[model samples]
Target: MPGTERSLTMRFLAEPKDVNFGGKVHGGAAMKWIDLAAYGCAAAWSGKYCITAYVGGMRFVQPVLVGNMVEVEAKVIYTGRTSMHLGIEVRAGDPTSSEKHLTTHCVAIMVAVDDKGKPVPVPEWVPVTENDIFMRDSAIRLMRMREKITEEMSAHLS
Candidate 1:
């Protein structure tokens, strides 16, 4: 069902299988969760199948333990004709405690697609509160950076 909601979270308990030889949850595994959460948020808001067009600024602030409780949050901060800009954060804590620490952050650009896998329009999103406003502005900045990089790459190719 389509929703006017702006954010979504997916939670899980990190397992040993998610760990790397260094004894921390693997970065790739965490990124997979981030993509899933972003997809859920985009699909819910657009009411259509969504595809990841770009992922930007992925950074890890801390490591997650194997037994920690993990939460991947995706927020819709901006929307274009067919693209949704999402901010994603990952947090983790001991499974038995409430204390959480930020582990990762990233921005994802997703495009709503139709049956033929072509881009389709996405619902508009407006930031109402101060925090939402900040997030929206950040998303815009990220979008501009992406555009600039693309332009620079094209010029190099030419």
Candidate 2:
């Protein structure tokens, strides 16, 4: 199945500079890639500049190694008045081969903004396929969970 315009895929080679002292691609580098991919998807879907409002459920399942071919895919799964929820996955494998394994997964919330940097409405997303529906539902669940966590933390910090 082909992705709609609301999705973006980025592919690149993991470089030595991305590696940590342990020789694996650093988590920060992977996070940067995730943010970039999510921003691209949100901007394309909304047809406006977007800023990351939140990133949740980020999990590093495996380490990416230098020389690996990295692929990051971001898909718009849900939407609010001004926010687009994106499901992002990062995968990596040998540069010479086609096989890839999941390295990271997360949901990012991006808010479209106007020239003045104020939040603006984004185009709504509708899930048409089973997979899309599943992703959207998952994103919603993650959002609810994040809200609960935030409330809990606020009680402690406030």
Candidate 3:
């Protein structure tokens, strides 16, 4: 069953407890859902315990409202020695409707860990189709961009 799970999707309904007095759900609540989905995908793919190392490009495009159904999808886009990069999305819509609007987008880097809590090797991911390749490449490019940005900031600050 190694390298079999490529994606995970979860559905939930936004409740009043998840929202503010303004009738919109807090972004942090949605982020928790994103983390859950990403963790599930990483754990399933690696077949080991995992920890979240990094979360990048978390943008909330829309606010979820009470009574709306929310769907969180996590897809494995790439993997490294110990990290699995998962592309995550959150969408929300009225339960009676067939349409959902994107509420968030992000990528999470999860590191597989051993009993000692140290990073452990994970199975390599292979792209089987053009879309798969594109997603993997996108994750690679995003990682590079983050590194470049970090380098630029460190150079300027010091």
Q: lDDT: which candidate is best?
A: 3
- Global lDDT of each candidate: 0.92, 0.91, 0.92
Q: Flag the better candidate by TM-score, 1 or 2.
A: 2
Report the C-alpha lDDT of model 2 over 1-158, residue by residue, as the tens digit: 21247889999999999989998999999999999999999988888889999997899999999999999999899999999999999999998899999999998999999999999887788899999999889888888888889988897884
Tell me how far the alpha carbon of residue 134 in candidate 3 is from the true structure, in angstroms, after superposition: 1.0
lDDT of candidate 1 at residue 37, scale 0 to 100: 96
lDDT value, candidate 2, whole model? 0.91
Worst 10 residues of 3 by lDDT: 149-158
How many Å off is the CA of 128 in candidate 2? 0.4
Give the poorly placed runs of model 3, Cα more than 4 Å off: 152-158
Which prediction has the highest TM-score against the true structure? 2
Q: State the number of backbone clashes in model 2.
A: 0
Q: Per-residue lDDT of 1-158 in model 3, one digit per residue for the tens?
A: 65799899999899889977677999889989999999999999999999999998999898999999999999999999999999999999999997999999999999999999999999999998999999999999999899998888897884
Task: Choose 1 or 3, whichever is better by TM-score.
Answer: 1
